[model samples]
Target: MPGRTGARHAVVRPPAAGRTAAPVAAGLVLVLLVLVVVRLPWVGDLGMHAATVQRLRHSPLDPGNPLVDADTPSPYYSPWMLLLGTVARVTDLPVFAVLRLAAAAGLALLVTGVWRYVKTLSAHRAAPALALLSLLLLWGTTPFLWSGFPGLHSLALTVSYPSTFTLGLAFHFWAWLTRAVRGAAGWGVWLGLGALWAVILLCHQFSGVVATAGAVATVLAARPRRTAWLRPVAGLSAGAVVLWAWPYYDFFALFGAGDGLEPVHRVLYGHPVARFGLVLLGVAALVPRWRRDRRDPLVVFFALGVLVVGAGWLSGHYSWGRALPAAVVPAQLAVALEAVGAGRRRLRAGWAALLTGALLLGGWAQAGTLGYVVPRGALPQALEDRYRPPWTGYHWITPWVRYGDVVLAEGRPARQIPAYGPYTVAPGYPDFFLPDEERRTKATGTYFAERTPESVRRGIEREYGVRWVVDRTGALDGTGLRAVARGPDGQVLYAVP
Candidate 1:
């Protein structure tokens, strides 16, 4: 699709009035840039997602309950996984490899989306470049500078998350909506928006809500004449809700109604100073221009998104709150860039060079730190490689563990052990939000905290159908379980005798 400015059906609007035209080359470079930045495949969500995607490849229509042994139905909707898995199968690459490629594609889309969003919002020449640079740099500023380590949260969204990619798709949806408001969009655009709506929901529920809310807020806050587009907006949203009714019902029934789970007080993610700084600058720039661009849909969208996200955080909705940074950073950057670009004549070249230098240096440092922490393999190579050590010997466990054969494990290993292999943890709830109180209580009381080895074994067998115990600390020696395999580090797989 050709770039169109001013919501007219014009197809020849370049990014700026007089920029060189190498869009294809630029796209290739952006993809290469993203591929280089995202070197590793595995991350926090990849294990479960990859495992699920791999399964869905075999049975694309029905990825029957991933966490249980029986054919228990699940409410999860994973169009992202289905698509990624299809790509992997077609390309004959490992699921992890395909995920890496997907990450690169997502990065490219985000870059393109950011540029387009800025172009649609402002006529400033430097806005697109500045926005793109701001987004790509210093995502680890808060974590790295404050805590001396790169944060996993930013990396997860940028490299592995389905919702992260949706940021781009969401922006594209916004652009089409902008066109729709001007009566320039066709039925095809409306159909496309509907498809994007479904894609966002199927990818990540939290981000999906965020996108919907942003669009709704923008539309509702639109000037009177633009409000006509609200019909399509409302129709698209209601259609999405109706189509995904079952999944939504299941999600609320099991996951959203967090009745028994302990109140999670900690924020899973944080705003990196570099990114937040850009948002602050955007807000500052937006203020002076408020009189002129007050009615811009993108302007209203950002304004409302900032307010809503702030309210969510203050209200202790941390899951959604934590998502705000990834959800709004790109748009915020565009706003700031446009603000700055509008006054380019007053902007100093020295300051621009300085800002660019700082962002590039910050990106380099974060990438170096990321490489150190990101482990190798779907499971860590140390754990996967055989004959390295008894601790290293556990890599063999995932394949041997039969489907629904309940196992006992914890931490990262626990999340993957069941998905990569057929085994399910006693309390192997795939989604932490969808807690099975009974199963969790049983595991906590009898299996994880048993006073004696015999009690632990008995509790496992009775409550969880657990036949294997993946002990990392060599603590299950006297539990009447044989050490089926042991790694060099002494992590052992104990079979119930």
Candidate 2:
């Protein structure tokens, strides 16, 4: 019913920037991130973590969940992982549910990083709209913006939580590197970051490498200013030095073995080409960007990281996770360059179009993963269809829970925790095998850590308010715990005294 003149204007001119409807795009990105975390983590390794937690409480002295090393310092190597198990038992929440929440939070932080970077560059302009647009645009790219969700396929079809963490570190590194490249006093940031990278390498080795490399590349790309090359060489050299030492030993010391020199394959640098395509394309994208913002170190660091990591992946030394950090930079950068200037308008428009295309393709695949989303510490009560038993119906007892080690039992059976069963024979738990040090590493039994076996046992007894040991698993034969319960296909759950 509008007048022809008003209608004519609608066709003649796009709505004013103020009159333009606000995009639901950013909200959609967040929603997608949440959904991805829920669905993918539910099906991913988080289940294993939860199962491990359940076993600890269900069988405090069981060898499978050993705290003390039967032989080494500790029986199991996943001490950091056990913290989550403890959290699961202490809060009585589902472990996977908690993991999902954490993943979602990381995704939010990444979005914040991009928004902050954009504002830093254009604080005087319409930062809010630009920030929101940048975020939405980045979120739209596949393999570029990982969303850090469990199953959200960001470019490269790579997946994992540490990937997002690496990306976050990349943002911080870019800021400092840019200043450093410009001859600004920014060595402190690089040094501090390198130390932090060492810690990350210890926990999730690949993440550290990707973060370090990506940061350096972004720095160089940001300004590409030739500054004695000493800055980057020194920063990267420190990281290399750390990688060569620490976990193993000082590399130089190994050569003094007189008659020894072991040519061990570097596990990290193993895969190279497989990770190159996305990396190469990203770097290629930046070829023209150098003129737009020659001072931004983030672009340089990201470019180099991607190229080098991609080369590593192809060489069979790189892992997908290691390359993940670098890919996300281009995702954000593409959005950042879109509003540069008039001459570059078409190029920016094409970049936006291409990113939009990639996102549409990824979204098509993500459609299948929407329903499986569960939190880290808890599962939905309506598992009337999810699991078989022992692992199913368990949800009714607690709103949130974690998973523990899943054991597979073979022939003969074995000794187990007292809470896990009625023990009368030598094969029975708590009475059969002695807790040996060598066996601690090899033994499936996981009771107390060598550090505080007595303490942990006592604590377990006190925490659960039970004098009896409860070993819960599906295996038996050796001194391993037996499965007292099971799923329909015959997956059994054992117990001990």
Candidate 3:
């Protein structure tokens, strides 16, 4: 894509116009790698996303259900994921390996994006370095990696849920910097639309509302030379078509619809307090400087983006993944704008130091959380959703299901779990008549609170060929059920004799 090439050309230019200062930019990227050290954010949503992409290799064009269909189940992401999926299907890349690759790609995109935009304005060989450095610093933070990590692993629309958000912001910033660099009198609505449309679709159809507001905000806040709609409309259409054609969206929603299962998109992904602070800082930084760039529309565009995100959350469910790109993209751009405009060398240097410190501190704090106590608290399910241990998913799962435990048992991800690999939990409900592959293979029986349906109890009895049951204990409640372990959450045991 021209986007990638453009950034490279700009950064690798001849040293004539204060150009050869790539070291600083490289340094920035190195420092921001704190998250990698902590292993805070797994690239590619880590396992599940890689699992889905790998599953689709055998069967493509699935229209049934994204989550249920192993071929293309990742609904939260866009279709671009299939590119990797194809590789998985053909070459047999392990899910984790694919995730690492995706993560690396995402890093490359973000770096290139920041470099090009910053290069447009920076001179003295240090400008691109400074801008690149700032972004690197931001990425360096643990929280930032956690927040942005999804962009790599999630397939289009699915992963783009967050990537688009980030990409949208990056797009807007790029447009702003392009205008500033090109020395054009006005911003181009057309260039901005290229990413905006994709962002809207990526965020979900509702994000269109946010996109609309951003258009108005840019017009109101930033002065642009041309207001032509044709070019923008055309670009937007193309991007949208690309997104629509991807199979990730096609299968997940249609075939897999159910009452209880929730897509990760429905829930907010960031800590409320933490995200709120980020929001406030963005506003504080941008608003105060708006008057200075009153003629520049990025400020107003940012304001509108913020409002829509907050409002979107209040009116409907809020996903931090959806709102973050809008906030961080502008916030970082504004920082660059301020530093670039500082005029005095000393002031620019000082501001740069302070900003770098803040970002690094944030990154440090983010990484620190993962050190010891956080993992127990931060499992995606612990803070954000309810999660049950995988059926037949304990350490001892190896004891029963030989080929594999009941895990890798079902779903689009399950098929890829190596045949008979009980590693992944097989489904439980919706068919009490049939045992979840894991439990069946492991000879494990289901026991739950009052919620356990009679049919399920009967199914348990039938499948295990036992009498008597222990609903109170975690173990098989069959006639052989026996007491083993007990806790406030529940009890443990075997089938009672």
Candidate 4:
């Protein structure tokens, strides 16, 4: 807040032509994203999210383990998903259709939130539009695809995820918190902010971390009077109450269950140069801002993100890598701000040129995302080579598998089968809260073992109420199971006799 006016005091407005072109470019990028969402390609965790919606639609109050047939609490039962579930139940729309609606809403919130937050930093008309583009396309040439990171390719794949919605709300939260701290906001406003903070956390825990870091950075940069401290404390207390009262899952308990996630998240630390080299441009922008004001919000925010992520790597809690956005966003915003705010015209032009080059390279690197909206064959050879095909899904098994029926499957099939309303014997993803996760996983392996006795396989099926078995063809031929159907990639659905 100290630098609210100081940071933009020497600002120089962009040219009229630039003012017109920035928004046009931003709008076109958004339209491309809309097409990607409309297509809803099956990639990453699509099956998991689809299954989560499927379960919630049938039993909103007690939608158990999303991937397995167990009465366990799931962190995925966020307020947003619950709302989507309600909409699905009322309209009887397919789960994927509801997800598309969710994607559109999340995208709108994200774009508007970015606009509002950028306005708080600078008054320039083109700043917001430039910030939007930088946030999406200023990453390194490498295609880093993840749920929380908003690199063009990643956002295209995870447009419908709860992480996207949560992150969008995070931007709004930071903007509002910055204003509240700078002004004389009443206790009621602070309390509402606190509750909103908790809701964001419940919606997506990883993004919640990013939001909390930004909130902390905002308050620190504001340098509020000692007497004003009570307001933030009060807000935090209110948020704690909401987290405790939420009945769907034990949000606090997740703190102790991160060990199981280290293996998967370790990858986030890999390929640092290819994934984040472009951020150095923003780092350069931040040096001047930091010199002008030690407590500059973007500088402080980037430091906090780096500290958290570095600690995660050193401490082996790689799940903390999700907070990478905290660092990346500030840097991205710095580049956008410097492009228009530099006092010297030459400096501004140089920054603008650098930014434009980075955007072009980033965009081309992520061009493969077009495969989601257009046919791969129609794409140029270079683009096609970069394109990764999406999952074909397990719709072929849906005719033989009924809703709520358990299926004994492993690997990719296990991941996708539940999207159609059936549960797998073991979860394809990590399940920290599920009490019987290890047992269920072991049972799935035992059932599919080539040397396991037929009697043992039957017992395992009876134990879990598995009505169908999906595996490679001929894997269960001699087990007295009847073949139900054959699916893509040589997978066969067999009935458990």
lDDT per model, in order? 0.53, 0.40, 0.42, 0.89
- Which has the greatest lDDT? 4
* lDDT of candidate 4 over 381-490, digit per residue (tens): 99999898987978777766789998889988888888999999899999998888899999988888888999899899889998999987467876788887888878
What tens-digit string does per-residue lDDT give for candidate 3 at 158-214? 222234344434544454535533343333544455555555455343344434444
Give the C-alpha miss distance for residue 463 in model 4, angstroms. Answer: 0.9
- Whole-structure CA lDDT of model 2: 0.40
* Cα TM-score of candidate 3: 0.59
Worst 10 residues of 1 by lDDT: 385-394
The C-alpha RMSD of each candidate to the native structure, in angstroms, is 6.7, 12.3, 9.6, 1.9
* Backbone clash tally (model 4): 0
Candidate 1 lDDT over residue span 1-497, tens digit each: 33336632222233442233223323443554554455543434545655665666655656555554444444444666677767766777866667677777666566667676666655545556655555555243432221111122254334555655676666666666655654555556666677677677666665666667656644554453554565676558655664556442244454453322224413433544653443354454455446655654545656666665666567665544534543355344544344344333335343344455545554443443333233434434432331111111134785556645667776556666644545455333434433463565456445545365675557556666778777775556666678877655567877876
TM-score of each: 0.76, 0.53, 0.59, 0.97
Model 4 — which ten-residue stretch has the worst lDDT? Answer: 1-10
